[model samples]
Target chain A: MGGGGEVIDNKQVILKELVKGAPKESDMAVKTSSISLKVEEGSKGLVVKNLYLSVEPYVKLRMKKFEHPDFSSFTPGSAMDGFGVGKVVDSGHPEFQKGDLIWGIVGWEEYSVIKNPGSFFKIHHADVPLSYYRGILGMPGMTAWVGLHKVAAPKEGEYVYISGASGAVGQLTKLGFDDAFNYKEEKDLDAALKRCFPEGIDIYFENVGGKMLDAVLLNMRLNGRIAACGMSAEHNLEEPEGVQNLRIIIHKRIRMQGFVVFDYFPQYSEFLDDVLPKIREGKIVYLEHITEGLENAPAALAGSENVWKQVVSVSRE
Target chain B: MGGGGEVIDNKQVILKELVKGAPKESDMAVKTSSISLKVEEGSKGLVVKNLYLSVEPYVKLRMKKFEHPDFSSFTPGSAMDGFGVGKVVDSGHPEFQKGDLIWGIVGWEEYSVIKNPGSFFKIHHADVPLSYYRGILGMPGMTAWVGLHKVAAPKEGEYVYISGASGAVGQLTKLGFDDAFNYKEEKDLDAALKRCFPEGIDIYFENVGGKMLDAVLLNMRLNGRIAACGMSAEHNLEEPEGVQNLRIIIHKRIRMQGFVVFDYFPQYSEFLDDVLPKIREGKIVYLEHITEGLENAPAALAGSENVWKQVVSVSRE
Candidate 1:
């Protein structure tokens, strides 16, 4: 075996305990452990060196214990798993080989042995920044696409409103949406929405729930559609805020639907084909707030204020 | 012209003033006025002898002044207009002939000349009680059909929950839905829902809204659908109650849609074709709370409690 086959020191961001309310930096611990940098014989796993880890708002939902069977909570004293860009160091799987760059659900560590590498998408376009796989070219990007085009099915000249218009999902939504607003800056969300859309919102790309959703409901036009992508505003709350104006949904004949991105994976290639050219031509703008080391990831993920997009860089190409 | 064409005393229920909150009997006054039972010479209208007037919760929305353009309030001293079954006494419109039975928007009066008879639907099936045209075979019936089958799209063996399950709309829903419960009797709605549907609700026919909607949201299964038919509970309130569990919509991947029966009018004949046979086979049970005479209509409409379907019987056939 080559010298590169030697055991390496792996740094991982471990969940110290199940989080309560908003996550804190203390809820996570950075641990260093030794790992063999070689794939075991007869194994169908890919040993990947994680290059970039996406810090997503939905990951917060996985930190708490809940009876929801669809989502599994992050195990205490183990590396947290999320969407990340990685390079395969060793592989026993047919689809992936050594040095193949891929992106999918991966551990928040320097290196991880992904047993089921079927979820991972091999990166074909290396011309763009590899980190783009974590944000604009990853699951979040596809979520914005499917939610807007498939669920909402917005028509031309229709008023579209997007909450969390500065966050990761929101930023991606801005590419397709005609009008966008940062909900945090608005004093009266209903008034602001009314000003932006005098007639009323025809389509609302909902990322933040609670007061934002309540306000959106009041301003919806007749036959308005709401594509609920995420509820970041209600995720950390012990008791989520009450939405009062839901009755407006009846008056306006609105259709509100919630969807997860996992269902839209089959359209990933189609999305890439449509988006890659626009990104290359500078028609689409992508931003990332990168934290340099694994040790700083906890603070960056838990309490990064006013950031456009949060990502943790564990290793370089 | 026949002797019946002579000017006759029309008993009309006039709105004294715009109603606030829950309507009261005092808000309306029964007045007698002279009117010719004949349409104008060249105008397209019909002179109708009102048989049965339907009392609906949405008619309350018209009692208050709102900027909503789709509906207009009843004039302070004019007869209130609502859905009713009538016999055409005279007609200038080609669609109607003398003595033709019909159902549509009509005044809360014994005899009146309708300027716009365009909205009327001809009653072909006379074997069923004409009063059934106001409840089980009319707008409320269509509401239940469109809401359950078209919007909610319930599958066989799917758990269906209907709020306001004892009301007119709910009664019609029970004809299609296997499991139905009156939310008023259940002290703990969540517990009641859990007992009714241990696996969680797949379809919810929303009628009451407010607190009931909040409770239903918590028990919705993944990919659940809610057809918002009415919000009678919130219609009377000055300030509608806030719904706290809307975030569950995201977790459960729910679709909630609000619809009006007017949009489903084109499918009326189609709906009747499907529902008429069921009624003839004694498979569908119809209930009516008949309030005799135009004088007692106000108290009957505004104060009738525990009544399944409230109908103002204006004239005998």
Candidate 2:
């Protein structure tokens, strides 16, 4: 209920062990103790009460530092880091003010002191449920916006095929498929694609690019474009079904391109301009699978390993 | 060598038996016939003494009906087709007149009659070797130009890595890395990249993507762009070498995109204008591996199987 209570000091959850396989609940410990929850005066930082924590598939990528990409290795003794909607209790940066609710990189606990706090985004649209900040209004939204509109560039009546359609990015990607989904699975790929669009898909937003990519290749209209955003379905599997349909790239003259979100961040403002309105107008929708509580964060991400657009809600909100 | 008998009926080579495996000289046949060394009155199509044939690896792909893309496959029992430069014997089109020189897609015979041609650039610079049309002034030139200037968008002093460095596209791509290539490969991939760059590779034009890609990944500068035009190595190998360094794409935030010549054809004029001056000014070097004589066309291409930028010459200046 967000009821105010005496400030709890130095109380935190500590990760007691590094997880090997799917992380278990025993991997983390919640503690009650004594530490100041105040932001240092004059420092470019903000102390925030994390109101809603984000659970995402990428955090799993961080859990084990193998090589390729975004997040730092999680320290064994420290708390986990993620995106959350937080209310700033105090701020030293000019861009942030006390009581300003923002969304950005933060910790798994109830509160976090974030340096370079200016990087955090101040929530401007307060009308939407604040928890949406952890998802539809935040990172996941940015992912869909960047991948679909920017990378794929879907056109009206364009046959669009999105992998992970049931997940966060998938659902959001479908918002572009039709005003309503006539969504169905085709038993035979060609028939399925034909069923999806007898006219043939002009743009394929390839969030999944193994078997799904193969299917879409056959159904693609001449001069089709494929935006290779992710390979989530096979990321954990040892062998993704081989992409035999790559030959379609030549036959149908397809243009398949791959891009990571980080490469397009410079266009973030432009992306937001295009997406924020759609989001506000309900022209775009996002599907999020949320797991509750910070203690369940590891398990939630592990559980979400096979899914797309999964989220974790760690706070009261 | 410049002398030949007159009354010599024009001799030509044609694809005889479309093969399932590597092409054989017997797969192509030569025949001689007589034609008026003249043109039909009021014919717009130009006929010429075809001088040089630009042999490209893509031609091998075209020879086989099995499709992968960025190029069209040659029809069975037809003359092979590729980029060539020739002199006009007869001019029927307004775009050309007697003795007017042109270069572009033409048949794989001694002399070809081209109709409804696109951008048959008038050879205004005779001082430049006409054979240049098969290489720098021709189709491969445009592919490299579009992939580099348009796709890769390379910057000066940025480390640029070109796989198949000895080939037509590779030579030009490495030329893009001009003056930046150092002699050593460094241990720290980034530093190794810097050694090649000391300035950092802003662009990578990827013609080969197995070990070469693995090596290029180490040398890629932050936010480097890759123009993934071809993967000849993997295209032929039953089992392509695993690229373990793919994670580098995420780490360096690199951008790798692929292309086909036909897709960029609409931009042909823009390409010529943007790149022609560079050619005229000697800012760019054009390389061609040419095989002489129509009878030797198959062997010309076959000889360069393991080599780069090798071309089979059908005719010459």
Candidate 3:
């Protein structure tokens, strides 16, 4: 192990170029570089040794060249940043100290110097798998919880429909969903939704947007609630598909709302308190496709897979 | 006048055929039918002389032949029913008496036997124009108030954008809006919205959907609220235009909700209590294009005129 401020080799995954329509593995390359394992003095920075990196579709959105205040595009010739589990190697902040386990935004590299440690959440409970922080107990899980409990606010026995039911957030929401089917397998999405929900959907956890959203709009019951978490289907396209059934919103008195997981960061501790016990008691089921090593991250993210989560293990503690 | 159950000629606006794309004057015809100007014995019904009939865009939606539980399409070759101000000539209902001014769903004929008098709201305050019962004090007005105050729940000084800003409900909402522009005048809707709302819109009263909705989606601020009151622009078209910018809902964390006025019927008296005073004090602005006689009713509803409310005066007194 390197001494306090000694420079060491840092293996990083670099975004080679801005992605256009769809992200390709060729757009990212693994590069080795030397970095001083030191937090800048007087700066509230933490030198984190990234252990598990979450591969999310939103990262691909950041890979695109765009100018918007909401999302800052990832810079070319730099390591792509995303949600990850990390150990603090060095800390310049009072709250965090060396060897503290945390989860937040981190670079796709062996080591990342988080300048603003305020965004990071300290790992309070470790009874569950540490990798769970990157999936079920982290951003995606928090998203599902917030979208369901806070946004959609479904009543008991209400018909709940979920698109992208194979993803991280979708899988964790098994308790609420009555019927599940692969949207890809259906030749007619509207017909499939009708078949699944004969009475029409009361609560729709919207993850896959575009055509799915269009079909769901037609099937939504009166005063139905749609919590739009993500639009994974349209994110990769240069020109997103137009939704044709928006008029149904008025006809059915639907409440379609969109939300981001980061907005519910204040309730993370509350979420952890509620979900941790459920997970430990075998009440909650979480699945992940964990790929070992940083080299596989590009393939894992770029390749289409029917997995709950695509997590890349950089360095297992 | 006939003493009791004498048969009277009822001049009616009958939907000649189910309208396909756009409603033409030819689709509706003025017909006369003889009806008893008396309620049946031991029935909770009121024989009403229809005074003012409101020409609404939703009535056009009902012109189409389709089966949906939410809305009942107007039966072809029958007297079309909509919001109207009427006076009770004969009453079998205990709550209602002769000469009581009322506003409710009434047939587009001179005299209507309202079977469901429970749906009707008695007009207690008549200091303001009785035609206001067909507009500013009626369904569309209730819709606007509910959408803005109840659904969107905008804060003071929040950027409020209203499309179809010259309609019945739209004209009545002059109190809240700061910027007003005709959507038809703008060459590019997105640019127009951007020019008007440089800071981006916070509350959007969505009356015109389709392309206007697409443009508004791009110009919405973070955590914006969209109150879907009506979609007048897309109602006439056989194929409604697809909204392409719905992803902005997720990016901006927007809440777009749809509501029908009937859903808030419980709040009708409350709405009237609030708005009636404002109208009496000349605080609320209401404009209407009143076309006299049942023969001109079809033309008024069909013609594209820049007016707040299109009301047919069936019987002034």
Tens digits of per-residue lDDT for model 1, B77-139: 999988899999999999899999999889999986788888889999999999989778988
Measured with C-alpha atoms, the lDDT of residue A190 in candidate 3 is 92
Candidate that scores best on DockQ:
3
Candidate 2 C-alpha lDDT tens digits along A188-225: 66666676577878877665555666677778887687
Candidate 2 residue runs with Cα over 4 Å from true position: A1-13, A40-44, A92-95, A171-200, A209-317, B1-8, B36-46, B68-81, B115-121, B170-200, B230-234, B237-251, B262-299, B305-317
DockQ of 2: 0.21
What does candidate 3's lDDT look like per residue over A1-317, in tens digits? 33357889999999998988668999999999988798766778889999999887778778887655556888999999988999999998999999999999899999998989998999978777777898889888888888888899989889888777777667577665567788788999999999999998999888777899999988888889999875243454467788888878886899989988888899998888888888888888777778999989899888846344888999988
Poorly placed runs, candidate 1 (over 4 Å): A1-5, A18-27, A60-69, A173-180, A231-234, A306-308, B1-5, B19-27, B59-69, B176-179, B231-234, B306-308
The TM-scores, one per candidate, come to: 0.92, 0.79, 0.93
RMSD of 2: 5.8
True contacts kept of each: 0.75, 0.11, 0.81
Candidate 1: deviation at residue B74, Å?
Answer: 3.1
User: Which has the higher DockQ value, candidate number 2 or candidate number 3?
Assistant: 3
lDDT of 1 by residue, A77-183 (tens): 99998889999999989999899999998999999988888888999999999989988899878877788888999888888887666765565655665565666
Count of backbone collisions within predicted model 3:
0
